[model samples]
Target chain A: MTETRLTEKTAGIRDVAARAGVSQTTVSHVLNATPHTRVSEETAARVRVAAEELGYRPNRLARGLRTQASEMIGLLTEEIATTPHAGRIILGAQEEASRHNLTLAIINSELNPDPEVPPVQVQAFLDRQVDGIIYATVYHDEIVAPENLSARPAVLIGARDSSGILPAVLPDERAGAVAVVEMLVARGHRRIAFAASAEDVPATRGRLGGYLEAMAAAGLPTEGLVAEGSSDARGGYTATNALLDAGPTALFCYNDRMAMGAYRAAGECGLSIPGDLSVVGFDDQAPIPESLFPPLTTVALPHYEMGAWAVDALYAVVSGSGERATSFAPTLLPCPLVERESVAAPRA
Target chain B: MTETRLTEKTAGIRDVAARAGVSQTTVSHVLNATPHTRVSEETAARVRVAAEELGYRPNRLARGLRTQASEMIGLLTEEIATTPHAGRIILGAQEEASRHNLTLAIINSELNPDPEVPPVQVQAFLDRQVDGIIYATVYHDEIVAPENLSARPAVLIGARDSSGILPAVLPDERAGAVAVVEMLVARGHRRIAFAASAEDVPATRGRLGGYLEAMAAAGLPTEGLVAEGSSDARGGYTATNALLDAGPTALFCYNDRMAMGAYRAAGECGLSIPGDLSVVGFDDQAPIPESLFPPLTTVALPHYEMGAWAVDALYAVVSGSGERATSFAPTLLPCPLVERESVAAPRA
Candidate 1:
């Protein structure tokens, strides 16, 4: 229990300007992050340092009443308890929010609880006067957000708004799968096998579709080259066993988990990775890819990118300097290939 | 990118009380979460529903100005980017905060940078006027917190504060380790080996200490049984291989990653888990324990419990209903053993 508050006198704009040896207008632009402002990095850093030293916190509530902006952004994420990568998204959003002197407050929503009504969590953000809302959903390809979300600048991540009114961003899972196949083909592997997941999630379809399309484009026969698994390490092991029976020289797993199984399967068969058999995976899940013996070469999802993009876009809207979404198409951010020791040329 | 404000008119506490057929005092006690008050769960539920129906939100700023409480808690975490379970901590704190009608804001601190000065992130939270702060660190056995942290009701997770004034909660890694050894000994395993970590962290010491203590109690010879590894899969494999030379019938890894390597070493040596040589791990890392075949039996770090405890403790202090920490010792929370399929009776 705190006995007495030790915080010093709250500093005002004039105090910050005087401390930084800058004009009040300059302090305003730096702290408020006004658009189209030209302040050198050095001067901006000085102003921020001065503000921190003087404990000058811009009265966000009062300022919101004056400028119709709260300088607070709300991120509504779904299933953070299960999704390991959700932290990455939060980190990106929080750091980017800090860069703009905006506070990023978060609330994790239960997994797609209701389809008929908007979540009450959105109203809580509005209660706190958040300037914008970013809803990150994974259960749906298209989501209908709370009608009141439009009352403030809002963006969607991992799903498009079915109303086609809100801007959205998603990872290109299909493209990432395709890239993995292409890389394997370039590595002089003709019979590249796929360990497909049996689950019916969006990613399963996207990844399988890419694998099939890439194989067809490479003029490779799919006959006996695809095996379905349950999307875990065991599934990978079983499916890789079947695919190995087909005499494939390379394996492209549905995800890093399956690739883990593939590694086990390969070790059982006494085949060294990147030498006797090349392997690749998607969804470069943390610790998994790096913890593997030879390490795994997998495709990384654009979670951090999506989080940063939402803030930058929302900040623009709040500053009245950027366009709102008018198109229904969701922007698919690239899933970059992370090469490690997993993929290599097939032996003669 | 919002076109217009569509949020409905705000509802006050009077309106909620009228809707719920309760007095304003009841509504205040329920919504403000005032301690030392008698309110039935049914009545609280009715009040909450009425508040939600009318889209009512108490003006936190106005109320805070009068009550000297911000209704906001700041959580500053270390190495959220790498600590896989940091999200668990955030989730627990957040859910608990919501239950108390408080907003939880988070700022992730980079790992152990500039050990002398207080992290600026704390000041950012202070600037916004958080009623309390929760600092979560894993790098230290005991740390000197920012001197000003005493200005508010503060709690620490994963480490003890040097000042001994701030209440802190830590996982009982040693107990968890001791439990595993005792469990194995109960299963008639006398030659159990430990795949120890080479990392110089608090966990490494705690876990090893528990194992050595437990083995001594069990009247088992640990000579030539403990082998050091790099704290990853490769390290586990090397350590297990060396330990196996002593003909141990069971293995305990420092963490999950090392257990992964132990699995590989077992597989290569033609040993079946829980059939020939049982294995256990610590940390219960996401995806790893479950992904491993035979599923690892391991210890959980009580991350969620710590997060929830910090919030509950802080709320008590804020409400002037709980004891402030005057002890130099940290509270050790139980690290529960999550028994999956990896452990079994050692082969006779």
Candidate 2:
């Protein structure tokens, strides 16, 4: 009711503990929801009453130190400013961060110019004093380390060949690619072509390699298969048109964009998806599989798990209870072919 | 080279300053390129020599507070989980962040869901102690204050009505839509249709409103215009297909994904871009515009400036040099019609 009430100074947690004649530890236990700790009901009620009256705010920094825990984690995204799927990764990371009572501070390593720890950035983290670091690359490659992160625990998301040095979480990329190719083959398409951009990026390479491996592993002809496609829908469209010239019955795309391109090109060529030419995509991103007149059946990366595992690893370090570098076996969460109106038996 | 050597504790700036018999201030001045502060040639040389010998790593946080003046800005993204253009916003923010010698720490508000200030996330910033906060919302709205942030300086990015308390940097939605419409109109398209998501989102509403304004302003018929698209590519595609049935010769999509949908539907309808139907899009999102067979002609948001400006505005408050709640007129950076194979004159 009073104007001064709006600007009154709030009391600290220490004040409440002092007023209730309880230790700061007890107040923290009550606030943090630490179960199994017993306190008399009357005493708890008294403490709550005092805290409510005083409007005491907790100093998380000091509390975190006492608990030997920091409810904060670092999320380092690779190719953040460039990749389309980066949004999904951040979303998954946020979901995981919420579930674990951890907050994330994101850094775009893409702009660092240097692959290793840019000195300036390292100091920035030091100033903020993050509990753990999660280095995420767009797709995955062997992520190189920056200088001086030994004191702080860290985790890697995406493709980093960890020889058991630090914890890493990567997608079942090879399996995803294989699933797409196998689906195309099941549709009775013999001459399947691959469309992808930049053969150098790990995910691109992995998908392409998986296609080849799946084809060869299945004894399908490797001749005249695979086209170097760009990482966008337009590139996919162009590449599909080019591959069609070679008389391929079906196509496996690197990512969703290229698959969208193939959808357009196929439509332009008057070829029915899965009826004349079956199309499969990797990295089931937005709109492509769902927005396409026929929903796309593409490989879905375990983005959510990658974020969750990375945080778990970080927390393990904070608790000093987990393996230093835990390597999670890539779990393929089925990129099973979603049969829509898209695929029909390929016309001979 | 011994592997153990890499683990040696690196010398800090203070160590170098002590060794050089110089004040930390002089060392900072030498490193930061400040002109007004004077140091003798001999003293400068000695300080440099000492710094080099000790392999001094400057404390970026401390140095930033002094001579460097925190080029680092905080880009506080709202709910990184569900936003469409947040990654692009981050990209623009990063580009601007680096251009200004400022680094960005993107924090997700979703991690903490406090009505006043979510319980989990605020501590992440407090520990890091970022110089300024840039509150970036995917859609514009009033900002709910995070607890204990009254002392912190911050700017609102992408909020239209900021309640006259926070400096806001948002996309000039109307101008952007106008630019897209103008490009289509200039290319000789008359029957233009608009595809947008829900009107609840400020961005979508502004862009859709801009499209209508541009249409009426250009004396074009607003009949049969569609604004029932979602913010995804599939939504764009479906909306575009429906609009095509209305016999529109050109389409101005809400975002790139919608344009992408148009591309697919166009293919399905055996229509050639620019030849049969022309399309324009907003947001030059990656893999969408570039991956398109003929790269998309779309309006791009000044994502980085949004971030950089937010930081600058926040700094104005932190430095106690500016008024609270400054407003940045949403800028329209001339969405230069990226003359691609998308749009052309209506078929003769």
Candidate 3:
């Protein structure tokens, strides 16, 4: 009620400056929260009150034209709904953009409709004159950056630009798989089995490769234990059922969906999770992990971290500040393992 | 690449007009793809080719200042990452926005911190001079519209504004529940049990209320049939276990997570789905419904529809065109049933 009454109409910067006994420049600096501006706390508070009392609403559009900064970042993400948890990436980017007082303008693209650069999508952002652009995708390991993307400072998430022009960030899928294996090995499970995905996506190779490297490092043989299946529950079920014939006491799935199948397989075989046959999965995806019977232990992709990192990197280039990473290898954010009740020492 | 060299530097609209042998207004109409323009296809093609040839990028910021249309809408969403498949909502809105040639500026807010309107967040959008604002929340049935939100055209998604001023759209939760029961009854399950969530969210009441109303209308007696548990898998498991003692032939869970638990309970009781027990769930949430061994028969909230609707509604109001719905009750989109493998007729 008070807010409705207090907020009537706009009072220009001049009104705020005159009311607060400050220059219009000071009012703009204080209201915009301009960096490197030294305004006393006492004066800033007075300016805010005066502005509020006068119903002063700063017009960023007018300011943007004068300053040549739209203060908007465009995010073009691919196949958002199908991905396990793309929302976290968006959430991370949106929040970090908010922290920097920049608005995130988002566009959803079809899942890599073709190998060609999405010049039309990039052009849309350029038309709006977004200060920077962030291209996010889960399907690709390397992408051809859109030609017009170079028109502004840009960043990539979940995929690297093949040309090595834009700074990029992605989850360390190999490292996460290694961590999962090391944890299981520490629990004394030498007969660990891997349920690999049939899909040829980058994640499949990264995860399987990590498993092989980690098993080798632990001086354990994976002969006849690494089975391939579709990267979902049914695949997990079939792979686990097949691997069970080898009498492995533990199973590691390519993803949480596959782990769901492993659990079902265990149930059918009269095995209790972490008791008779311990199981673990990757992509500690929401609802899947926590909703499972014993809450399956899994590795979490650094989706949120990557999203946040992209914005920070883009902002750095936008403002021409902050330590900008050289474009070479994409920054690999850690995919940490989340422990739940699904993993335990294999039954003696 | 041809695209890089072709997109080298900017060419003013005047240059495109001169090259295309058309006026600047004709070039603008064709390039902006302004609705209802009468420019012939040949002329439109020529203008586009000229603009492409000269690399003319339209300055939306300068155009916005002159025309007072930012061509942007701000979407303020609450607890985006935690919601079940909020990305679908985003995808729907974004795709629709793209169709209208409008950019969707998004900001994710923490789950409502208080009943007090989030003036600061609203102010941020207002600062950017977004032509309209869309406030989306899953936690509330109705909310107080922020004070300055009235400064521009606004719409609500997932919740209604209490003041009955701003137009809103929400999923038909109660109707969705009714559909589930009717489907079960059609499958010959008279003794259908409901695994209700213990949480106090509006979804709980909306779903449960639909069940009770539908049951009563079907002339089915509500004996010891409804069981309550937490809104997740564990809750579904415990509730399903207890309800099984009642010898119900079918179980309808509050959501898919609970259905997961129901699946577990059926396994423990040695009951084969359809032959001994049939199960159904709401929120045909990704991976959950499809990943289940027999898959799941569930209801899908019109998340995508509502998202698209909000943008269309906002656009209608922004342009002062289209059948602008009068502010009153919230528009309810349908929740359709997605049939997988879990549901079937009970055995004789």
What TM-score, over all chains together, does every model reach? Answer: 0.89, 0.79, 0.92
Ranking by DockQ: 3, 1, 2
DockQ for all models, in order?
Answer: 0.49, 0.31, 0.78
Docking class of 2: acceptable
DockQ, candidate 2, vs. native dimer? 0.31
Candidate 3: tens digits of C-alpha lDDT, residues A168-256: 89899999999989999999999999999999999999999999999999999999998988988999999999899988888999999
lDDT of 1 by residue, A177-251 (tens): 899888888889999999999999888888899999999999998899999999999999999999998988899
Model 1 ranges off by over 4 Å? A1-3, A6-58, B1-3, B6-56
Evaluated at residue B112, the lDDT of candidate 1 is 62
lDDT of 1 at A192: 91
**Tens-digit per-residue lDDT, B1-348, candidate 3:** 323423655678899999999999999999878998899999999999998888788888888888878989988888888897688888888888999999999988776656566567788988888888888888788888776787777888988888888899998999999998988888788998999999998899999999999999898866889999988888999999989988898899999999988888888889987678888899988889999878899999898998899899988877767555565988999999998888878888
For candidate 3 chain B, which ten residues in a row score worst on lDDT?
B1-10
Off by over 4 Å in 3: A1-9, A17-52, A115-118, A323-325, B1-9, B14-50, B323-327
